[model samples]
Target: MRLRDLLIDIEPLRAGRDFRAAFIARTVSLFGLGIATVALAAQVYRLTGTTVHVAAVSMVMSVSVLVGSLVGGVLADRSDRRRVIIIARSAAALGFAALAVNAMLPEPRLWAVYLCVAWDGLASGVSVTTLMAVVPTLVRRDQLPAAGALMAITGELGSIFAPFLGGVLIAAWGAGFAFAATAVTTALTSLLLTRLRPLPPARSTDGGDGGDGEGDGHDESGSPMAALRFALRERVVGGLLLLGGVTAFFGVPVVLFPELVHTRFGGGDVMLGLLYTAPAVGSVLVSVGSGWIGRTAAPGKVLLAAVLVSGLAVAGFGLSPSVGPALAALVVVGAAGTVYGILEYALVHHSTPDRLRGRMAGVLTSQQTTGDIAGDAEVALIARWFNPGAAAVFNGLLTAVTAVVVAVAVPGLRRATLPAEDDADADDTGADGTGTGADGGPGTPSVPLGTGPAPVAAPPRAPAAG
Candidate 1:
């Protein structure tokens, strides 16, 4: 293959300046969150000297994020998306600032840390969902995969480097400096958000074609519960979610890493840390070289293949007797999982209409969080019963089987294809200050800002049924 074909595609960033801004903002914000994560863990462990207290804070944050995602989804569909994101991120910035202040205190209170974590988690949940919903609007439909890949790269980079940076900062100046740094990054994200044009909710107001009140898309609006109902009712959407849930539920091998390192590999702390980081390294390599992801017509088939590969790789890891082979297996697992994730994100965005995008994204986020938490518990229990390797092998096989089952059950998803790009289009924005449609249409309908409500985009056609 050519070098260009093996590199990360930058077409989405080149498509519009707004997308560029969003991309940079997302990268910054994710890195900031990652840094905060390390600092939070260290501070909590220092204050309480118990892992249970750390877990308690994490649980609190998880619940808050869940609740915030639901509420944010509803608000995104009802209000101006840009406004909601700005407000949510600004609140998170404030929370970070508060954490900075608390860290600087002579006697840091554990309660203050918990409160700040909860606050940040809730705000992050809201901002992230709204941002996901807005991304498709900033680029052409065909650029979705590239956008997804780029976003995935940001996450991988953050996971790999932000903790190291956080540790360095803490060692040099203490946790207060790290917290202050995060606050600055959060504030920068909010500032970047302000540069984007107004993004009103795409749901129509009247009982018209895509109206939320009472029409064709009537059932689309309202709370996240309504969105959940819609997802279960929709064939392809439901199928995708089902497949994702299955993979997530069986995909956690991290819980077994400690036992495997101890008993199977006879390794210490350093080796265990290497095992934990191997997947992230693999994910980053694949994501950075995902240029072909956007050009593929058989994305659904590729996604299924990725899941199968991931399962087999995990099984291979579990079956490995030596460290070298085990690390290689984990690398393959990470690469395969990254492919699956990029395709899943693009497919979800492609399938969902603008009006319901936020709610659907929220649902996906919630499902992932819930699945990971549950999977950790389920796999840990299995390992406790049989053995770590046995649990890994069983879960890996289960995940592979789930992928095969989904392929057979969801034919529509299996045959899915992205919309074609328009060669004539230059960018998402017109010189006249109007926005263009994402579906290769001429221009989105517009209303003057401050005159009344911002104009909503016309909803696109629904996905093929499974």
Candidate 2:
């Protein structure tokens, strides 16, 4: 199919000035972050010459991101989302600047690197949560899946180019300049955000009967733990969080592939760059086709299939002897990863109300961070004992186990349908009871037993007019 036709069919974003501006800003920021990822890995390896140190950096960033996501979620629920994003982006810019200066110093301590990573992670978590929370407000509900696909495409595009560019920059102008470039891009992103009109903060409406409101209620006391508890109680939100954790656990080990190429395959920077590019190439293709995938299948099923496929592909990587085969395996892994990422975001967005979107985003981010930390530790330990290829096998096994558990335990999640745009307007009659829509038709089937109904079973309604 033609690209325009594909986009029209799948994309949820409206062609508006604000969306265009935000897209440009987000793209630039993602590209910069991608470059920084490669630069950071290279710098860490150069400093300590150990895979363990590289893993430690990832650990530090993950922990910081987890904490930041929690805090950011609480703030996003209360404050203006745009302002939160601006502040977070500004903080990231400053962190990049700090890293750039540290790179120039004569004897940069390892602790300095850790501190920079922490700062960057915190800013990144906050910014990401706020940005995600703002998405529903920008586009129509029917377009959310397409918008999600577009976001994935932008991220993959950034990943596809950044490693090669990072290597080139590092080789020509040192890691310092690479970080400086990140700072510049970050500043530009902040500027773009500044130009956008202010977005409304999430509103909390109290039900007349003193019952918990339609939206997730915010405890204005600024307690992160309370928000965490609320998120845990949300059946769909919690499920998505669990799914995200699984994805991170199974998928993030790919980050270790560069080190594998260096030590096991005796390839240097160029090979490392190619290894990073391999999955991204697959991701780009998958992202381009994600719109079709979303339309034809339930998101949960797509997510499960992606995870299972990724697991098998990763296992293939473990068995491959040559770099060519390994790269091909990575391509498979990347395609699955792309589909999984899109579904994860869509599920989270669908499950959350606008009021709690920020907190939900934060919760999701924290889960992802926790997963990354755990995955990194697991991979590092395995690599220290066995070969990197063996570590890949372990990661694949972990993914398979998680997928199986999710499929069995949360059968509702397997094909949980997206609510029609007006599902929220339908009368709430507790779970499992029939409710009528504004159009006097049966609405979403809410399963009280927790094993939700299929999406296709949703009541038929006239197609919404464009």
Candidate 3:
């Protein structure tokens, strides 16, 4: 393939100045989180060496994040997303500042750590949901996939590299410095995001469409229940979500890696770390060259194929005879998984109406996390009955097989098409400035943002791309 095909999609960055700001903010925020995660884990281990104690600290953040995600979704639908994000990120920065202060103490209080973690989780939850809700408004309809690709790439790089940098900092200075660094970055993210203009809630209001809801020809006004109802009601979206659920349940290789190192590889700690990090490497490479995938007609098919690739590669990694082959397989799994993720985000944003976006995004995040925890528990149970290797192979194979089944069953998803980009200006909500979206001829109707029930209309056929 030519290098151009593999080149990163820079259009979103070039086209949408606001998207560029959001992208930068995402990179900074994730990096800070990664650093804080490592610092927190190290601090916990220092205070109490037991694995259970470490897990306890983590659980506090997890519960808070879950709660925050739900609340953030509701808030995003009710008010201005840009303002919500600014406030949320500012709170996260305060969380890190608290961590820094606690770490600097001669003897850091364990309770303080838990408290700050909970605070951080709440702030992050709100930040994440509102940001996901805002991306479509930052870019054109056609750029949604590219936007997704950018986010996945940003997250993968941040998660992969930031921990290593944190480790270096911790070794040279201390956890206090790491926490301070994260605080500074979080502050920077908030400042940069502030440059964005105000974004009103996309929830439908009566007969008026959200003309200010960023030009996607959809309205954003509905209850959280409406978001859930839409997910179940839409065939393609439901299929994609089901796919996420299955993958999370069956994709338990990460949980098995430590055990596999001694049982199969005879490797040391460094090797184990390499095994863990391999997928991120693969994901980064594919993201760098993701332009070609965006040009394809059958995005859903491509996503299913990605799922299949991930399943097969992960299974192969589990069954490999030696370290080299297993590592290579893991690389493929990472690349494929990244593709699946980008497409899933693209489809979710493209298909869902504006009003329900935040809630839907929050729900999907919760489901994925739940699926992961459940899978880890289930795989551990299976390992108790069989060896870890056996459990890994079984789970991987199941993931691959199920992906095929789902793809064959959902033709609409395979044929899914994005709406053409339009010249809808964000400032023009309606002729009356009431936030009712402009009336495109025969376009699809969204939930009314007003007090009364809004009218629903059939959408026109999507026009060809420019």
Candidate 4:
């Protein structure tokens, strides 16, 4: 393996101008969102003087994200992705501006903060779903791993900076400035997107339909129920969704951080800051060194293993008596979590046909957001009932157990094999139900697993293993 391959892949950025634009847009927007994330919690806490109120903002955001992603998925499947993104970004920017305005008030209305957050969450869900759907369209199949890697790295880096930046802005200036900065970044994203190619839904190829992508048949593909039905029918998709849910709500420890810092660690604000930043640091290190993962053919196995590792890491963090060990445990958790995300994105993108992509993306986001809120709630509840350490250990062990059970039970996902593009031109209906053109009639074989591809000039290859 050359040293260059070990570094982050840049072909996704190089091969497609649209991908590059979207990449930059997401990175910039994430930074802004990061700022908003911190500011929102701080403002809410300031106003209410209670952790519960601060938590409410996150809960509202999660519910709104679920609603938005569900609706946005259907829209992404039926309409122009570019347009959906533009509208979503615009709405989100406006929401941020509202936050800014609310912050500037002498006595900011608490309700106004929640309102802006809900609105922002709705638009954010739309933007995230549409953007995921648009990736394969913008770049070749081979570039997906790189694209996903880039996205993860950008997000981690943005997250690392945004909190500190928000703290500085809020301390030096105020929450109003942080909110305004987010608004500006969002507006800039919309402006940058003006040059990207328009993405319309891929019709017949989306979910095994044989017709050219058009007309009323498109309506069903755009439905959330349709996506749900497909997922139930496909164990691979269902399994991945389950894994994500487990990781989100059960494995994530965001809600318990402050409590652990104050009680278990006996640390103050500085220690709390380190706890928050540790994951991003680990994620960045793994992302830049992600070349090895793409070479693995059995990404499903790898994905499950990543989950197991994450669970164990969290368990270790829970048991660690010292801050240093806890921080080390966090690094492992972060790396494992990042790999899981990359593989999940690659595997899902590769398996779904063009039409169903948007809906699946929507479902993915919805589950993830729900898990986040639920996980936080559970951890907090557990802390209240027991101790933070016990909660962490319990969740971590449960997450690991869940992964093992899912891995053993979900045969389709467990045994599924991604192709190496040897028969890219072979005509076969990929188990994904996507149709392909193959002149070699009976001799041609479909993709080994249930995953499929639709008709396209260049056959849709297996998704990247990033």
Candidate 5:
């Protein structure tokens, strides 16, 4: 439970100047993006006065992101990730600039807004896939869980403050300024990225064996289809991706909450902001505790528990009568859900080899994007047919279903082990760290934990004291 030890574990990855700069840049960018999300939603609602239009905008962006993620993932596998990231950021900045400029026009054009959003979505898709894919390259394998936790922390920090701040900004200066601010932040992020050294190009297979550094041992001119096929066939990766889609469907209720507040609870923007913050607070707490959990428990078990808790919490939200109870339920749901998110990323990182990491990340991102789109659409349709409360209930049920299915189908997932810290002392660790049956190789197949084998090495240890 030493916080200092947890922090130091990730220090080696931060040793490189490029990595640190990129981290800071992304952190700032995320904050700005958070603000922009709130501002855009608020602005769009004010202009259109229709939830359908807002949902439509979201759907468009989601589709764009899905496409970009798939394309970017393939490119990342083939090219220099550093350059790909820089280009994507630049495009994102330009897209933000378009939004800012569009906001200032005499008559705001909805089409223009949609166009900017589409471009922004595409850029973000590419950026996200590249960044996730590149993380394994920056840090050692054993340090990945900590790095993933750090990432969750950054996102939670952004989520915690962004909506509140965005609301305040919109109230004071309007959406145009918010868009301009996002543009400035995007540009600054790109500039910060420029300070990093170029990443080496990804290795090509070129007739070499699949051993370390020899390449993925595939043909250099391999079809793009190869990446997709690899992702689909990899046991660990495929299961995680399916698990991700399930989580997305279950989680859609959260996005629909603002409409629920407006329609059912008779609340406005202030309440909306508070509603958003409820889950975020829980996510922040979980992110803070993730390092400790990663240390002792099997990550897969942790993931399953988180998903189930999140599902039950969402159901609780449906059962609650008032805002207070709903908020509390959201808190639980958010915390557990964030843990699920971290574990999902960890699985993707660990399951894929280094060479195809980018493509794998892209596929995961695309699946997530598609899931969001589908989930939101489902919620929207349910809301149209029934009440917002019914939609929430349905979403909760969906989560429950996902948890059960994952519990049953993905045998490897149920008992999947966290990547143990590579410490010599950790060789005999089990799921609960109580010792016994803790050999480094994969754990026995279990029902709730899924069928993926346990990691083969001792728990990864923190870097030796300098």
Candidate 6:
């Protein structure tokens, strides 16, 4: 209720040197990736003068990123996480440099553009997953919400401005200059990562069997499939993953924006652009005022509430007869979506153990990408079959209904809470899966639903390139 509760918290950056470096590096890297995305699309279009060719390049990049994320998960759990990030980022920087050189040439080769983009996409996926996995090791359990809020802000900023900046650079100078700038930012990220302390995989952070289940008889920690197996056994994690997929599949109706604008509002290019930017503007506002998120006792409840709000907002956008109301609805959609994303992020990390964090992060990254891409296609098909407005209305209602269903079904998620500040090195979950109080007894109960036991400590409680 206090005014200070509304502001974004920067405690993680101030208190942890490793987190600070990673934050700065991540912010810069996100911008670079955004810039590269725009430049690559433009250059490919110019070279081939065909949208099909551009689509092909994008498909290639997506596939490469998918492959990289899976491989990165295994690497992150098996090797030094810090080294994984550094190597991945360095490779991306080199790819960007290659793109810059190709762009500046008298006759730029389209093949080279494809090759470099594929290379960059692979590297970006690895670095992104590894970075997400390593954050819990850098900060205390309670600081995760604040850290997630900061990450969301940076991602939104990149989404809002990086593409515009890339376009400006391309128009004023050339695509080559934009590519070169991205190359510099990525290289700088690699340099920043070098300052981090070596982070090795914790095979067993709490001396458990290193598995989430009752001795699954398989030490799957080093395997990418370990995340999948873990999710199957953990209902809270499974519910969270499903919540994310539902939001992505039914909540984000981006592909239908143009059709809705043209048919319902009789709008042109400018209106379309405004429609696109509205949600991001709303997201930035909420992220800046996200301080209260860290203090929430029932994060799972909040996440579900956000999901409901987001779905209803989208439905409102579909039902609105005029532009003013439509844009207002979109702003709400963005705000609610941001809240859901930030909470979901923190809860996932809190629930996961350090040993499987990397693989879990990779699974999340893949799930998000596949969800968004599949969701877009699904919405487009619905629009084609019926109408854009109708599609939005249906999807929005479906999303809202799914949230209610999840809240009722997943008690662990609904009851999940964050304990007050505990010891930095406290074991949140006991080996037998019970709450461990600050005095090493039962203090405040904050447990994830269906995860066997609540954390004795605190509850174990992207997507750009991810």
Candidate 2 lDDT by residue in tens digits, 115-202 = 9999988988888777777765565444455666677778778767876788899999989899999999999999998865676554
lDDT of 5 by residue, 60-158 (tens): 888888888777777676677778888998898898888888777877888988999999888888878877766655654445566666666777788
Question: For candidate 6, what is the lDDT?
Answer: 0.78
Candidate 3: list runs displaced more than 4 Å. 205-223, 419-466
Candidate 2 structure, TM-score to reference: 0.81
Top candidate by TM-score: 6
lDDT of 4 by residue, 1-466 (tens): 7997788888667756777788888888988988988899889998999999986788898898889888888888888888989889999999999999999999999999989989988998888888877776675444456667888888888878878898999999999999999999999999887767676666553333422223335447646766666566555767887887788788758778888888788679889989988888888998999876655666777878989999999999999898999999999899988888777776666656566677777877777777777787789888889999989999999999999998778755655544343443243333222334221123232232234332111111112110
Error of 5 at 437 (Å): 25
List of clashing residue pairs for candidate 4: 203-213, 206-355, 249-375, 427-438, 430-452, 432-451, 432-452
lDDT of 1 by residue, 384-459 (tens): 9999988888988888888898878766666766555653144342212244444222443221112222221111
Top lDDT model: 6
What C-alpha lDDT does candidate 2 achieve relative to the native structure? 0.67
Model 6 C-alpha lDDT per residue in residues 1-466, reported as the tens digit of each score: 9888889988888878888888899889888878888999999999999989987898888778777888787788778999999999999989999999999999999999889988987997898788878876676667777877888888888888998899899999999999999999999999998989887766453344344333547667666776777676567878888887788778768888878777888679889888888898888998899999878877888989999999999999888999999899998998898888778777777666666777887887777767777888898898899888888989999999999998888877787765456543464432122233221223323244554335421112152232
* Candidate that beats the other on TM-score, 1 or 2, i.e. the better one: 1
lDDT of 4 at 35: 91
CA lDDT, candidate 1, residue 216: 50
Pairs with steric clashes in candidate 1: none
lDDT against the true structure, per candidate, is 0.75, 0.67, 0.73, 0.74, 0.66, 0.78
Ranked by lDDT, top first: 6, 1, 4, 3, 2, 5
**lDDT accuracy of residue 122 in candidate 2:** 90
Decide which is better by lDDT, 1 or 3.
1
